[model samples]
Target: MTTTTTLKEQVLMTLKRQQANALVLYLNYKKYHWLTYGPLFRELHLLFEEQGAAVFASIDELAERSLILDGQPVADPADYLGTATVTPSSGQLTVKAMIEEAIANHELIITEMHQDADVATEAGDIGTADLYTRLVQTHQKHRWFLKELLAKGDGLVS
Candidate 1:
């Protein structure tokens, strides 16, 4: 295949991975939101719902980007958990555990975004690189919010 074709395929694969991850994250957030209990329920339920909405938004953007590149986005909900790099949690978890899991998943996505952005840049696909950059920034912000909730005192670190 031509270099262009190969690069396009690689970019599409990366985008698909991201799309899967976002869907998994969105579901996990929604699940946690519904299952949240204890005194922190009010706050955590709202926060998880908000985060889930953000992740749901990213999912559409990723799929549209894939379509724009003339590639098929993964469409089956059943395929998401298998394709996603992020681990999905089921059952009950404490608020702190849920927050920690989210932070871990966001970090995973951010790391993958950085790597994918580099790949896109190297392949001379600036638009894909820009998309990955925006994704990284968004995940970073989400991570920060989760980390802050886990932080002690001044919220400088977690």
Candidate 2:
């Protein structure tokens, strides 16, 4: 492959990493949606489903962008879960634990995206940079949302 193509491949890897992180979180959110029970059931159920949709949409975009960069998008569930840097779930966590895990994943994704954005910018990959910038903002919003839940307590009651 040419230099440009190599750069595109790297960008593809970055995008895949990003999408994988979101996918994991999305699944966790949906799990929380099903498992959450309390007075906040209705509120948290709707909220988690909404968040899942948002992350699901993001996964599509990330995969599309990878294809645009002349790489095959990593859409296989096994592939995503296999490669993601986010902590793997054992499906045993409570609702509050789920929330805390999502927050941590968001922070991790932000850091990864920032690094990828810097690399893309240095490589003159403006599209990748822009996409990663948007991703950073999105993750930050997610982190803020989770922080709202965490700030009031030890992340269990809120």
lDDT (Cα atoms) of all candidates against the true structure:
0.86, 0.79
Superposed model 2: Cα runs more than 4 Å off: 1-5, 154-158
Against the true structure, what is every candidate's RMSD?
A: 3.4, 2.9
User: Tens-digit lDDT track for model 1 on 76-153?
Assistant: 878887779988886677777788899999999999999899878977989999999987998899899888777774
Q: What would the per-residue lDDT of candidate 2 be over residues 1-158, giving only the tens digit for each residue? A: 24656666777778888878778878777788888776667877887888778888888888888888777877676798876787666667766787788888888888999989987887688998999998789788878886787687753444
Candidate 2's clash total is 0
Per-residue error for 110 in candidate 1, Å, reads: 0.4
Model 1 lDDT on a 0 to 1 scale? 0.86
Query: What TM-score goes with each of the models?
Result: 0.90, 0.88
lDDT of 2 at 104: 83
